[model samples]
Target: MNAAEVVKSLLVQRFGIPSAHLNAETPLRSLRLDSLALEELRVLLEEQLDIDLEEVSLTPRNTVGQLVAAVDGVAA
Candidate 1:
């Protein structure tokens, strides 16, 4: 799966998020993921995607599409 698909899968499977609530434009905060959860997500993404997230500025204000793009950019 691509970064976006991995992200969406993680959100739904690990976080118990409904698939219906997820979309490219959805804000991170809308998923109710706390700071720790976000951190965990970062680690999970890094491990799963084999990409460094250190340079990526992820915030609650960032949309899912933005995060996916950041990961894809780094992976490429």
Candidate 2:
């Protein structure tokens, strides 16, 4: 799967978010993800996408589209 798919799947399976509830405009904070959760997500993204996100800023305020772009940016 691509970065977007990877991100969506992770949010659903690992975070227990409903798949149908996910969309590009969905805010991370709306999912109730705290900083710790975001950090764990970063680790999982790194493992799945095989990319480093240390330079990418992650915040609960960031939207899912932003997350996907960040991952895709590094994965590319």
- Judging by TM-score against the true structure, name the best candidate: 2
> Each prediction's Cα lDDT score?
0.89, 0.94
Tens-place lDDT per residue, model 1, 1-76, is 9888999999999999999998989998999887788889999999998888988878888888888899899989
Compose the digit string of candidate 2's lDDT tens values, residues 1-76. 9999999999999999998888999999999999999999999999987889999999999999999999988888
Estimate candidate 2's alpha-carbon lDDT, on a 0 to 1 scale. Answer: 0.94
The regions of model 1 sitting more than 4 angstroms off are: none
Q: How well does candidate 2 match the true structure in TM-score terms?
A: 0.97
Candidate 2: residue pairs that collide: none
Q: What lDDT score goes with residue 44 in model 1?
A: 94
**TM-score per candidate, in order?**
0.93, 0.97
RMSD of candidate 2 to true structure, Å = 0.6
